[model samples]
Target: MITPGQKIIQEWYKVKEWRQFPFQQEMEATYLAGYSGLLNAPTGSGKTFALFLPFLADFINKHPDYKTRKNNGLQMIWLTPLRALTNDIKKAMQEVCDDLQIPWKIATRTGDTSAAEKAALKKKLPEVLLTTPESLHLMLAQKEYPKIFQTLQVAVIDEWHELLGTKRGVQVELGLSRLKNLTPTLSKGEGANEQVVKDKVPRFYTTDALNWNANIDNAKQNRRQPTEAENVLWQFLRGKKIGYKFRRQHLVLRYIPDFICIEKKLIVEVDGGYHNDAEQQELDKYRENELIAQGYTIVRFTNNEVLTNPDNVLSKIKQILETKSNSLPEG
Candidate 1:
């Protein structure tokens, strides 16, 4: 019989046109089996999803109405070395939640986050929070730290290798130690009762064990090659052509954009003949909805438009960028 977690995975793969890699499947199975250990996979090899999906599936299986449930403290905490990665991870996780129709909230508590956001977090925590080691230590120092982490089910440490043998790494260890003590029910070696198991310490996962070389190789294999239209648009937008840094074949959640300008929150898709098919159009619509939910402005151009009417395509992109830039609050 297929488990609830497996069913969710099957649906996700079908929607995304993705096949689970060997290591991803192994990690997912291990997580569902209620085992916790280091996950060794290449970066961008879907490690985040492998660790996140099964845990989410289990949560949903136990609480089918989790979307309607009130905030009950944080359910997951993600740690990473750089603050910049926080938003990227948040988008990825948020995409999954949105796709699954789960109402789980996600937030970031980094040094750069505003004071207002931090204050709000203290009153009620989001379901998932992406934070740095130092920020996590600060949270632990709060008077109600125990209450804050009472519902936490998992804690993922990204780029564990960078933290392993450093002072910050030691800080993470100390923080986890205190979190374990405060939430004894969730710690490992707990009793066999279901309630006891639920209260056990949050499962810990790290990328330290991943083979760097293998990760680089896998990234190469998965990288999307630009199409003719995409290549043409890149020539005009490459190297800050429009006064903004545009990334080509940028990965946003499960979909890779043909061109993305992060600063302008813009996504450009260069379409070919296949994009006009009814089924592909449905998939494209779904993809666009996801991006729009993330507050991105999407612009699409056909292969002929980019190749034949290149100037018009560039003008339209420039107009969107300027319009968005004008709406931003001045520094």
Candidate 2:
């Protein structure tokens, strides 16, 4: 049986001709299981959706009448390290929400936002707000800060490694502490909800168990065996290639790439003859565009190239990885 989250994901894949990656499914399951931990995945690995999708599924399931619910309070807060990333996150989330027909609103609050925009957000809060740590701290300073976050369901810290071991990271910690205090009833391990669970079936586990199990089953259904072309490329890209780790048959959101180097945010797709079909080419374009939106540098090679001129393919990949490494910000 397909679960509600899987159903929604299927619809998304149908529209995009994509498949969800294994790590994304695991993240969704972990979130639904009521566990919070650091997501150490590289950029362009669909971490945003991994966190966002479960929250969306839970919100929709719990509040079927979310459209009728009061939209005065914030629902989720996404904190990113760079102000430039705010718009990218907002656009990506809005696209998903629109695709799912969820009437949630998304906005950004960063150092670069206009005063007028900030004032409007103050009056009517969006359901999802993407902001930087400094901007978040500023919001916490406001008199109505607690009320603003009263309805917040989740807080996603993006590019966490960039902020770790810094004063800004400490500020985020303090802000979360304050949010916890304001919503004592919603505190992680507080209150008397155990009695309600005890009154239910004796063998029942948390709803997380149901979600996790459903996701596991859904992943099995989506898994596919690699093609001969994919098999060839995997042999070359797998393990360590020039000191960087590469994953084969890796999943990103709703599509699998033949080869991916997470550190460089690079994806290599080995295409077969069928990819030349008009419809198939169209679908491939859609897939590549979506991946590019997540900051991935996509490279494509024909099956012939991978099987015959393998050295050229390896050289091309090595050059791209080296270029990306040199462009990385100095620590």
Candidate 3:
């Protein structure tokens, strides 16, 4: 019999044209089980892929007509906390969509998106709208723009841990609750609050995750009749859960980005606390010189600068994403 995990992989292999790991299986389980919880995992854990896979599978099964129009309209909204991460992630997501022959297009709409580009994006509404929390809030605030996001079946928030405790997080949770209210009866939490957070401010919980999982199961099929390939998937997943998993495979998959400058044709390195130490400072200086030697306009900011005045942070990042809206890579 195909284990539930194996069954998930079978589905992915057929639909996503991609392989599955334990993480992806769990994502399918949670999504299929009807749970809408933040996926708390390390970067490079294929977190975005995990969340997007189910949606992509559903999109192909549901909307096969996008191939004719190619790269158009508001289908999926991927929210990232930082504008700096937008281009690279968007490029990656779009490339995957291309490989799947899914004609969905993604655009970034943030404080960084130029006025002209933002206007054009609104006019076109790329199929996948990868944007920031602030930009999404802008879309939701418009009295006449509810339809812009009404078709959004799945909203994946990237770098969620950084957002879970902020005002932005509150906006997302409330927005999610609103979306659930419209689409399904999931997230039936009566906007519960303790004496302090009676206002239904942002938060997360293990119980919430469990309850949510129970619901994503609403749309998924039970793992009863998986094929032979699915049976192999089940055993593989069982081994994974038991800690007899892939040796060093996980470590090798980590992602390391070459820095980008959002201003002055520059790549900025806003330091975290780790770089404040003397040895770390020396190391950073060496790295900076190396980048500069390679014709990169590298700049650094104190961790304090990022923590205290992020207006300063936005000031630096605004330029890179302001690139022409038509500035897509050659296909």
TM-score of each: 0.57, 0.56, 0.49
Candidate 3 lDDT: 0.53
lDDT of each: 0.73, 0.70, 0.53
Task: Supply the global lDDT for candidate 1.
Answer: 0.73
Best by TM-score: 1
How do the residues 1-331 of candidate 3 rate in per-residue lDDT, one tens digit apiece? 3343334337647775666768877776566545566677777867777887665654554455635656444667787767788898888788777766666777788766777997787667888888766566456545546456545556677887776544345445545544543332232332211123323432332224432443333212223333233233334333343222211101100111122322233454444454444433444555456556655455555546655665655555444434313222357
Clashing pairs for model 1 are 42-215, 185-199, 185-200, 186-199, 186-200, 186-201, 187-200, 187-201
List, residue by residue over 199-277, the lDDT tens digit for candidate 2: 3422221223433344333333323455566667677766795677887655565445667787788988787774664
lDDT score of residue 84 within candidate 1: 81
Give the CA lDDT, 0 to 100, for residue 297 in model 1: 84
Per-residue C-alpha lDDT of model 1 across residues 70-96, encoded as one tens digit per residue? 575798899887778889889999999
Going through the candidates in the order shown, the clash numbers are: 8, 4, 16
Q: Each model's RMSD to truth, in Å?
A: 16.7, 17.6, 21.2
